[model samples]
Target: MTASPEPTDAIAIPDSPLAVLQQVFGYQSFRDGQQEIIEEVVAGRDALVIKPTGGGKSICYQIPALLRPGLTVVVSPLISLMKDQVDTLVANGVAAVYINSALSREEMLRHFAGLRRGEIKLVYVSPERLLQHEFMERLGELELGLFAIDEAHCISQWGHDFRPEYAALGRLKQWFPRIPVMALTATADEATRQDMLSRLSLTDPLIHIASFDRPNIRYTLVEKFKGIDQLLRYVAEQPGQCGIVYCSSRKRVEEVAERLLSRGHRAASYHAGLPLELRQSVQERFIRDDLDIVVATVAFGMGIDKPNVRYVVHYDIPKNIESYYQETGRGGRDGLPAEALLLYDPGDVGRVRRLLENSDNEQQLQVELYKLNVMAAFAESLTCRRQVLLNYFGEYQREPCGNCDICLDPPKRYDGTEDAQKALSCVYRVGQHFGVMYVVEVLRGAATQRIREHGHDKLSTYGIGKDKSQEHWVSVIRQLIHSGLLTQNITRNMVLQLTEAARPVLRGEVRLELAEPRLVRVKQKDKGEAVLSRAEDRALFKELRQLRKQLAEEADVPPYVVFSDATLTELARYRPKTESELLGINGVGMRKLERFGAAFLALLRRQE
Candidate 1:
């Protein structure tokens, strides 16, 4: 980190946002939609930004924070997020501090003094702290420039991770009418975006919704069978890389973490059930690259700024697309190739549905169940996973994304026109009032009590599919839902309902093709795909990582805070021989070049 403030001369034109981007943040140019958003904020207009994670959302505000006058107050959701961002900014020679519970009273007062002296460009605070009367009043005393609310979706109930404290943030606009408020989030659907605009009272904000596609992330959905073995195999393939495995329960988290440890992986469990200090330690360890994997429940991984997460494995399905997208988007933040592997089981659908049904709020439960069905549909989708994901967020992509598993290895198809007709006919005959399990049972000639009570046994469709296994029928039904020939009504007990598209298929007017039932027990590929493909580059990258880890240990910061893996990969790829060439790299600013240039240059010199 720089020992003193960055000289104003570093940015040749202090008021120019592009100049500040290159000089202070070391980016050669603004990413698409970033420069316009930054200019809007700098021009004193509110903005609601809906960009995907790793999409440079921070740059939309950070550059403006530097170019605009006065201190920019950023509202972040987690202390770790604040600290990581502040550390990154400090490393880049920008004066930034986070005011949160982590700080001692003396440290808080020192930061307050800095703020009073106008020595800090940005100050981060939590929503709860920002709402405190004294802190709110104290902020009024400063020459406030902008209020950038990170994870702004938390303010809305419609968002995946809603916090009541965020709802009170609308007072910021009322308290400081002229200070432009920029609410930014990586995950927000249409409803969540509208709710945020209303809840945060963003005044006629410029809404910039960047394409929600992470092309670098390869989406893979694997059927869950012997899930522990599958998880172990997946993790084994990515040895020594940092990743997160998300489970649905604390017990599952512990079990997975224990199994991983037994298999000799650097792993730990994190959940709210653990002691606060233990959770904090696990998080810190993971961020520092001391832990190769963290098996955790949904309680973890909000506002995580670790850019080099190689993969995110969902040991179980997520509750919604927003949660799934945000969680999986945690990987490949460094614009490097990464993977999102979800081990999906049909049984998990019932478990998740039951969990959501317990919610006392009927409206909320309905919303959750609807989202869960959509999540399941995505998992069971036959088409491009990226297409299904992006289509849900209202981004239409006609062309298939070649990075996903479906595109890479297309499933074997068969002429299942008769089976599709059978499934569709069964749904219609059974009155379309049952879930997949019940429908499958009816089709498979199961004489269960519920079936007898409903008199479904006497229906024409009953036992029509007896030749097919229950798993086969279930796959057919799910595929039909994904093909848009049927819809599941979540509020009506997730009953199967035929859509208009099903009419033609049921009447045999349109031939249908479906995937063969995926019951074959398969093994994960044992190959490890390294980002640095060449042996010599990988060797140099390893040495650079070692150097970074040593420096981070000495500096008491996460290794990424020194230099992201992406930057290190670039350093290894393009062996810069001089200071100018090194500074030309994307992540190296003047401050970092001055601080660690000679050490890296010496290492490169030795590599020669």
Candidate 2:
């Protein structure tokens, strides 16, 4: 709860680092909160950065890693993530190495030896590895300059990716108390932040809570009756663009990916249940732009550095706002325009509620549920998306973002003061033991078999909402739930209950801007053969695909198992004539360029 210190004027700025940041990273200047956080880390002070997932949290640590002396030990949560970060670091000419479960004993020992020799400037390790006795002893031998905990929120039980080993990190202070530790996370609410501080044993750390507003990301939440058809239409409209579709389960991930593939789109499935090799292959393909879309669970995309992702579609609502923010942050990292869509239903909320009940820590569970309530409010809110998100992070955003769906096409809001009172009265009369559907049915005068069986049709409030349809009543109830006027009783079969905040609204003391009910409209498809007018370019693209197909075939891989269409599109667009140019593409690497660059370039030249 402490405020961040005022910025000091004594910090020196070098033109070289600024030039690299602007020219290579393509940023004009540091964002408002970024400079102070960077200076604090540069000064070797322990700091905690709570920025929104696309708010440039990486830059906070990356800049300090570049400026500080000695190597920075980055403890990440996943093995695949370490590989991605190390690859990017090496690409940028920063000496980096990773030790993870993927490595053999000897291989890991070699990396540990490298760390002791100070041969690497950045060493990425998983929390599990850090818990190993041998790895701990090896780490003790190294002269670490800075200890960075990426996704630091995971150290708290409240975080989405909470790992038991992260709690073990408190022992780091025992070994190297003098070394500054910078904990960086894209999403952490106030309670989660405090939990992280206590769990990590951070000493009076400077907290940098950046504004969570993402202006480039236009937020939209739609009723999810016809989600798949809507998703297909949205993706088809943005042809060849990279995006991620997040589902709740592995089964859904595979099903969605297969459905997209069947519809003639480049897509793939990713989840933790897959074989390590298969997961790596899918991740490589997606990163290389060999796949246009990746249907994945929350397990994917941690520390993924792909910047040009255009959209993130949530097939189900996440458990909390932190999870949602981090997942959506995956899109639009390149500072380009992107969209985040959440397709959800009342069933999704039930699923999340069950998950909360199943968690081990009751306090953390309550905190997470509260965060979910906030996210639900955001989804059902009639105000600007940017404003709601920023407000959650304790920042005031006055004006509408103009880019979000609600801002572009504002929802119709009726004066719901009286309706609020009726809903509240109904909940109170029904004994707070019935769910939204039952409550709504009673209000709509629906005398279905269940309603009559419960004898609710005889109640005075049973037909009060006869003027509105069932769907309309449901929307009003949902909005009221989000407004803190109503609470879902998870223990009592997820029933609706009135809270203290409901009194003013129920008594017609406060006006509420409730959103209108949304309808799902199916999209029309175009049935025509795809045409290519650029014969020469099309021929080159074909040859590139063929060559990729050949390489993948030799490797016993899928077509996208080699290079993605995005890479091919870039090849066709840039017409890169050399291996060097090819290596500069988003997903192309030195290994790939060395192996297949010549053939791709030769085909391009032959076409010319």
Candidate 3:
């Protein structure tokens, strides 16, 4: 609940003052790249911190903000985020204020006046506000310490959430030459990272990249022919669990949320088109646990601080792996077991393909699209899902997770050496101008009119794979594309070509492991039978919920505004008998305890 000790001597140099690292920010130690990145920023160097979400990125800037002599200006993207951050800072006894567009003219003037008088340590502003002439003029007058760009990936066109305003951040360095700048993003691929540096005009910034692995999250991809029914079943099984279901379309979000609500789940929909106040209210309710599930599009989550989200379900496949990684990273922030589920179909791939084709940079977009197609292939892959996911980020795992579907019910591997050779041969024979469907047809010896006209049936390889269905061969090609044995060229022509790794397989020198495609069928389980026996736990949970409701009523706030279901679950499980014990709950800060501790304690004592 308290701020960790700061590292004072982490950046101490001979020319700099000799001080212990723990004396400054009240933190006793440094995380993986905190000390190094902090030193770089303090020594007036530009840097990019690519730490994972909840990976102590704040310390990189908070420490530098305290160490430097002037005010640190942070350009955030959301109003609610700025408020939450500023509130936390004030609670921690630090001076922080924000100037968002939500404020009235008078309110804005007062906050600007506070900034000018040097009464604030940090000032959070949206990019649109910072672009204002009056705000820019005021910013020029202030002695700025560090210009921090949160969610820096937005600056890159290749990133998921691209903002035009972020591209304009280069002007900051031009205006304030001596001030140090640090850019931070929770997720960025190699392409995105390079684009951030180039777009921001950072001068050889020191790059600190933490590991992308979220070991606490259990990744699962379920094929859903009846997606809505399956989704309802899953949600019912995890009753009262806080989770997010991402839909590609706003309509899908509405439909999914409505379906969940009809099925007796506390669910809500959030999209860009929603009313501003309604969106804010929905977000607040979800954070407070008045809502158990939030069905949203890409618009909903950026800088969300809810820590105990137990699951994240992707209703549609994302456009790229970076977006998928960042979205799913929202789960398991508290280092507890969490799940990432994706219910996808092959048609989703075509939709994503069209989206990529419409993008401005076709080549970069194509590469990213291929990456997504690889993810789709991964969803259907018989190998450990974790292995394929980690492989995309340029990391590898030798052994299976032993927890994923493939590991639990081991897939039977067949000798695909001949099949691999035939698939690769078809690519060479077809002149590499055809798509996967065409390639599969050619290999399966299907004597269609087009194939006969092209004289493809005359080839020796024709009819060789007739023993397999077209779908089977298509799955083979997909797995090959994902395994790095084949590459899909999106432009010039959408065709499959063999990569270098496929050479050995084609020559029969190496055998490839291939799993037979199984028809995924979701068995209907009785909802009552599926529910775990948490009778005592549920009784305590209800008591805690009632206590929370009382506190919210007294405070005139929503019940969730008091505490999250996860927090209440913790209280029930731990049975925090004392105030000190209650303080250890994730969302129970000093202010919350001071406001509602007695009511909760009274209920706990009565239950005991």
For residues 327-383, could you state the per-residue lDDT of candidate 1 as single tens digits? 999998999999999988878999999988888887667777778877987887766
- What clash count does candidate 1 reach? 0
Model 2 worst lDDT window (10 residues): 1-10
Those runs of model 2 whose alpha carbons end farther than 4 Å from true positions after fitting are: 1-29, 372-377, 414-608
Residue pairs of candidate 2 with colliding backbone atoms: 289-564, 290-564
What's the C-alpha lDDT at position 66 in model 3? 62
lDDT for position 219 in model 3: 81
- Model 3, range 1-608, lDDT digits (tens) per residue? 11211211233212221132354335567768788888788888989998877787877886677668788999899876676676656655566777776676776677777778876668889988887888889888988899999989888866766788888987888888888889999877666788899888888789888887787888876655568977998988898899999999999999999999898898999998887678878887888889889999975766777898999999988876777888888888898988888886777898878877887875567666766766676766766776666655545454567656567665657887777788888987887677888888888878799989888888777778888787778878876765667666543455777767777887778767777664322222443112224787679888888878877888899998898776776666556655545665667777787788888878776766
lDDT of 2 by residue, 1-608 (tens): 11111112212323354654665456799876878777787787888888776677777776777677777888888877877777765555556777766777676667666667766667788877777898777767776778899988888765656667788887888778888888988877555687788877777788888777777888877756556877888888999999999999999999899899999999999998999888888898998999999999997998898889999999998877777888888999888999898986656787888878888877667656766766676766666677666645545554568987678877656677778788888888888888788888889888699889878888889899999777678777766664556766533445777877777776777776665554221122242112345777677677788789898988887877577776776676557554434655655776676667787888776755
| Residue 106 lDDT (model 3) | 73
Model 3: which ten-residue window has the lowest total lDDT?
1-10
Q: Candidates 2 and 3: which is better by lDDT?
A: 3
In model 1, the worst 10-residue window by lDDT is 1-10
Give candidate 2's whole-model lDDT.
0.75
* CA lDDT, candidate 3, residue 333: 89
How many pairs collide in each candidate, listed in order? 0, 2, 13
